[model samples]
Target: MNDERDRLEDLNIEEAVGRSTPPDLAERILAAAGKRELDDAVTPISGRHAVPRTHRPTGRRMTSPIARKNWQGAGVVTAFALLFVVGLIAFILLNDPSAPTEQDTAETQEKTDQDRNQPRQRFETPTKKREPSSPDSNEEQPTQPAPTDEPEPESEPDKPEDVVDQPEPRAPVEEPQPEPRDTVKEPEPEPEQPKEEPVKPEPEQPKGAVEQPKDDDKTEVKPEPKKVAVAYIPEDAWRKYEFGRYSVRRSASDEWNSIHGLEKEMGRIWLYEGWQLKTGTGELYFSNGALLQLDGEVEFHTHTRGLRIELIDDDLYVDNVASSSTVFVTHEGLEVEVGNGAAVIESSSGKLGIFCVDGQVSAGGKLIAAGHKASLSNRGLSSINEVTRRDWSHPLLTGARLRQLGIEDFDPAPLGGMISGKIETRTAEQLGLDDDGHVAVDNGGSASVAFRFDGDHETLRGEKVRVRYRVKGAKKLILQMFCPARNDNFGTDIVPGKEGEWNVLEIALSDLRNRETHKDAPPPGTVLSSFALALTGQDDAQIEVDWVELVREAEFEK
Candidate 1:
């Protein structure tokens, strides 16, 4: 047995790799390969490499022991392959210190067999129900362990070997023992979801929810009692039945009803047509809040609003013109407007006189100031004289009756003619030019101060309308001419002059633009219904009009 063991030891792994090789072994190997040796081939002896025993030089690796081996064609290659495979397996078994020992493997294998024989208790990896993720969190939400129906994953018992680290550190497969531990976990109950209630449609308002009133149950609105227009005589006022008396009638075709007594009610309770007080004096009141005192022959014709006194020649005093009402006194060619004031208007043979007592008067485009006298004619107004003591005063107009109109505190200081029938009269001072009395207006958000002229605008057709006036807080000043013959409105905006001073703008009538077409206006014929000057801008603006001058200019070339 000892001889056999020695023999086995000798054949264990060929020879030691440190043994030197023979010189002629290379030539023999080359001869077997059927090739000649290289010219530079030199042999190197193994023992004393610094010196050579033979005269010829040897190769650097000629003395190696393994090269001297007498192996044949494929025998050496096969031996090397077997040795490499054996070395790889030995390295795997011995590299890791944590790798199982032979005793440990045997113990574990014995335990595994015992466990299998008793009964395989299949263990399942606990699966979890994933929790709902929060909208703001980036991390995955951990899951809760839940009971599952699937059995244990016993089929992959050797799965840890595959999961272990790669070959260099792979042998300690038992260290990753989570496969069994991950299977054991306490079961967690899932959170119950709240149930949502079903939404029902809302019912509309029931038709019978509110009871309808029957014909008898319905309430009716009582009609408002209308205030009637009235005229009565006051006992304190004096009157005369001398030459003629006051006459009242309904229509123009009806006969005049004479009023001679001191009867309180003279005019009817409604609108009447003819009124002629041609005698000493008369006092009358219309329910429209208009009080009138006529001195001479004064005739109040028919009117829809207030009185239309067509005086051929008479002195008529008016007061307390009700809200939104007018008292038109049309004489020869003179237009005089008085508001809450006394004025004696006289006319004798183409001559007229305006005597203002308490307030200002606008007569023939001239402001007749209080305590001043002005001569009025067909031409215009002139001869202004201040009176120390007023010679003319109203006998019956005591100003006590204005309270019945409810506007006793209201200032109707006449803003001149806003239009034909929309004229409010009162003496107003405007700026420093109040010596001639100016008009300030606040027609309830109407931003205009307009004056209308009934005189001949035909002569001014081809001329420039030069106006001299002082204004405050106004924007554009518009001059308009309404032609009845053409039935068109010709208007032009005057460029503003120096501020805080009187402005004189000479605008040609030919330059008036057609409001609709925004072009030069055509010739406005002789029949112009209204020639007006209006200021537009700044609410409640004031304007003092000195004069509306016309310069006769030759017609422009077409």
Candidate 2:
């Protein structure tokens, strides 16, 4: 418009000064506008780039002088590196805050002494502080929480209540004391048991003094003492007594026959004779003279006497008989064993003491030159001849010793002539005769027979004899004549009888062998004739006799 609008306003004002003039901008705008217009160049160009044509600054605003002197030497080394990083951050916050508070108080006292000694250090540090925390109670596995600031427990919590409140404190020790001496002493001895207790009390005091005398005499005892005896006596007063005491009265009547002491008067006691009555009683007989008896118990019809024979107590009895003959019978020296045929005739005209107690007898005539003499233990010394003419050879016959005293057989020729047991006679001084013819055939010719004989040799010679002569006071009387078959002596005789008195003899002997006027002699075989008796007495003179026998044939038997 105004020029074109003024030429388009000068082409829009020179393209606004060539677009603000840049192309090295005139070397910087003429070096500042040539020193800026030397003085007051602009003060207001500030931000928008302050457009300036050809002032060139914009390659991001311009720098280049070598980059501006390398940015002002990098601003003086960055202001000294920012004052050395502010003094090294204040010297690491002043020595790292007391070295982290002295390593945080020595790691909180080594974690409160590893939480009281490493409670296993939390099971030994797994991954520290890695927390996902929550599982706690199976009783709270304890570990961590220890540090100190004020929670003090470093060792105290060394637990179990600190091993129960801690009180073991002692240490400083010492004591010992005592010892240092040497004294010096020695002596001891003793124990011998008090000298054996006084020698055992002297043997117990004699056993308590011998038991105190057996306990003090217990009751007055004295015992022991005895002896005393005496006896002896004998001075004969009939030699004293005592055996069976005493006795003797006697005299109870065994027929006194008026007797007073003795001397005859005991009659009637015949048999073989025994009689002593006068109170010592005795009477015996039996060979048929009969009168055997004893006390009649009082019926005395008489007959008893003096001391005919007696023995009492050893009892032999008899007395006062014939109270009709059977009053008190028999028993004297009883022994009458007479058997073997009895023909006993013993009678020496008187009995002094007769005992034959047996049998056998045969004697002929002339009362055999007076009496007495019939002795034979066995038999011997006997003679009888009816008529003698003296002649006897060997006629001392006791044949076979009288058949050994039991005489069973006998019969030596009987003619009333030879009666002889045995006979041998001579010794009148060998028969110059005298000396009273020395005949002693048991003192015959008197009070019957006196006997006692035990024979060795026996004899009896017989013949019809008659012999008697006893001159009690001598004139002459001597005879011994024995004849068996032939030695002979036939001297006649003279006689005297009456000294003790008794005699009667008449011996014819067949007229001295005339055999009644010569009957041819020598027919008397072994003949023996006898008649003998001669005694001038005095050999205890006893003569008495009675004779009578003349038998040729006279048989008398009772």
Candidate 3:
């Protein structure tokens, strides 16, 4: 059994050696061994048989142990050569320094195309692991790899021909999805809006010539007529009449007869320039409702429009109850326009007076209200003063009217005795008192003048006396109250301030009693017969007195 096992071992070894050996391997081993044997043969062999040992070839394959050993050695040599070849191939694969392969080229081309189409990408730097260093070191340290000696490749301009042809990578296939039944498309962008400008309004058209439609046919437009202000009179109207010593004239024609004292046939009468008319003791009435009464001479021209009279001289009174435009002009250049009532105009050398009795009158640029008087002069008009009841007295006071006061002899002796002066009564205007025609006492010579008020004794008892006087050269004035029936009297002296100016003096009737000297003086309620203005010891003094009035003390205070 041991011999059989040795044979199987030897056979298995022989098979392995045969598979590992090359076809020319035996010839190479034989050539190397034959040469070594020949060299050994030259060393001169010491044997009787000097020939080398040679074996004859047989037809059958040798299976000797020595042949098996040779086969084993050849197998070992073949295994070693195969291992050396594999190591060389692995080294070449790992350390190859060539350019990119085909797949890498495809990926690079796709990345470049994406970069050109999409927006630019910013490369992020890789973070490197930091090595801790000693804090004591002050030398500058390199934070990154140092620059290499190799020059960078020049970036060539991209020519169309230099671009390589590469197939685009296929995108991954996705699973098929079900199609929706309805599709909604996105709305397109709206067109740009236009800017707007401000709009203006239309202008207004005129009134008469307003714009009309083009289809209108009316053409003629009549303008309204203007108004006219005038009065029409007949040719045969009564235009001229004569009264007392005056010749009636109409526009310079003096053929008209006198219509004086004719009541029914009275009408308008026109007086020419310088033609005087006197309405002597009767009023002259006109058919146009004008009534004129003259105290002295009056020359006037009558306007046909409104029967306006222009007075040339003297004084006249008009009752213009029927006309509103009945105006009168004075010789002193005053225009007195009366309306609806009576008015009186008195004209003298350098003065004019207008009194509105019942209605308004416009005189001297001012309206004289009813019961008022306007005293005007060449210096224009003064302030209008209220008219008293005595202002409407008779226009003229003659000697006969003065004699009716019981002083028939024209003497001052019957009443209070006068001073060494002549007493003259004149119009207030003549005495430089421009009041409306009130009487004034003028003292010519001067020992002091005295005038007595001749009224009932009981009329002024217990009444206050108010006197308005204008004095020129008198320094003082005295008023005396006397009861002639009782033969007792008392007097009060006044030092007049504002010489040559009008002043008012008021005295209570009770205050006139002489309490200091005449203890038997009259009581407060005693009736006084007369009051006198007696100026004593005033030499060369001229005094003009306006008025003296007795009123109740309560009325004077009001």
Candidate 4:
């Protein structure tokens, strides 16, 4: 063993040049030894050299000793390099481990098939530590001894090539190992936790998904979504919203007549060519299933030929999403939309404003996408502004644009209440109003004031009534809500925290409860009546209000 290791260590290039001999000196010694042997065997020709190597070979060299001894040392070096490289590569491959061939594997399978009748004998992978002096060297190192139970097979004992070619010496035929690409990779040492304490895992991701990192050896489970109960809408949705008393005319020159009673009535009413809306907020359903809600002092004329609405004098709200034809909202003969669209229109002085709440709308013959506001006048002047990052909830939701005014709502209309209060407007040269406009209220003495909601916003998230007021010399404030469903009043007392500072009172319409029973009396979102605020304790108490906004929350907030 000692002599075999010493001879193999001599072949190592790193250990040889570092300790045994210098690389250049070894080459020179080999050259000199070869020359001396050739000189003793053959005579050298004086002043004569070998033929040029680049030219093709003509015949065997039969003359010079230089040519004869030239290939001997180089042949030894080349053979040594080839053998060393082959053995190193083979050792690396065998150590890496692979699936054994049928001849080497000794798996004990039941006698189900002919091949599984007898288990094959297992053979260890043969290792090579060859240290050859040359390709033609007669000296060869013996292989390591196998286990005592399994005797090693003797095949071509004198030749190393025969031992390499016939890896399984005992077997009749050589068998190749399974290809590395086809074999499954060895599993990595993953979780070392005890199998008895198995952890609950998250919803099993689809196969081939990358595993997420573990937290305290536990996988978090995803929550299922909550289902929301939606109210069933009937085929005749117009019956739900009690339509107001409207005037109808057969022709443009004919006089209009009041056909329906003044109370809140249900059912669809067919409109003629010259049908018009009278006083108060009214809901109109066209023959083509278009729902139009008109508020303020809007004098809109309906044209059933193309489902076009002509705003003759005031403003209108067209949410014709269910309409079969394109519900066009025209101001002064100029249409705003050419497709199925829901939009809000408002006209204050001479300028007209069209806001595309959803779907597409047209402005000055050019189409604009949703969430965009377009302002136009009869003088062929128009400007379009995008209402970005806004999930507008209701048709009444509008505001000042591009820093024109800091006010949020501009569509404030007086909900009927007999009181002394002040109303203010915040619009200038354009129509960007959300709530009917801001109501700047100032009380001269202790008195009650009321506000009305112009449009009935029955949205998914519902509407909110916001009131901001400040009082002096008042002990308690009363917020009374008039519910039309009960035709009665439900109020709650609000104790002001601060005396002179503005106190905000914002509550959802659906959250409004009756003070007597603490139950939601209305049970509906369309709180279209009046909201009254009264100061009863102090006689000389003065109240100052900023604004009262009736708006809906955005979609993303839900």
Question: Tens digit of lDDT per residue, candidate 1, span 1-558?
Answer: 999999866654222221221212332343322211111112121222112221124333233344323434355788799999999986998888888998997999899776743321121112212335311122333333347665343321221111211112112212111111111111111111011111111233343353332222112111112212233433234333422345444333434444432233322223223444443456554433345666665555424443456565556555532112445566765656654344556666666666665446677777776677787778888878875433443343332222121101112222223452132333434334323333333332224434443232342223456666655666767777776666777788776566557666667667887776888565633444444566665665555444444443222111
Per-residue CA lDDT of model 2 for 1-558, tens digit only, reads 455678767765554433221122222333334322212123122222121222332333222223345655776898899999999976887776455565666888887765653322223233323445422211234344577455533331211110111122332222211121112111111111111111000111222222211221212122111111000011111123322111111134222222212121121111101223322222233211122222221111111311122222222222111111111111232111222112112222121111211122222221222112232221333443222222111021111011111010012211223222222243445433343222222342321111111111112111233333223443334333334444553334355545433344543233343222333232222233343444444455443222212111111121
Scored by CA lDDT, what does every candidate get? 0.44, 0.26, 0.45, 0.45
Off by over 4 Å in 3: 1-276, 300-305, 322-324, 395-558
User: Local error of candidate 2 at 445, Å?
Assistant: 23
Query: For each predicted model, how many residue pairs clash, with residues at least 3 apart or on different chains?
Result: 15, 60, 0, 10
TM-score of 2: 0.15
| Per-residue lDDT of candidate 4, residues 114-146 (tens digit) | 352212111101221233332122434334557
Better of 1 and 2 by lDDT: 1
Runs of candidate 4 exceeding 4 Å displacement: 1-257, 261-266, 296-305, 388-558
- Whichever of 2 and 3 has more lDDT, that candidate is 3
Pairwise TM-score winner, candidates 1 and 3: 1
Lowest lDDT 10-mer window, candidate 2? 400-409
**Candidates 2 and 4: which is better by lDDT?**
4
**Candidate 1: what lDDT?**
0.44
- The reply for model 2, stretches above 4 Å from the true place, is 1-476, 481-529, 533-558
**RMSD for each of the candidates:** 50.8, 85.4, 62.5, 34.5
Q: Tell me each candidate's TM-score.
A: 0.26, 0.15, 0.25, 0.27
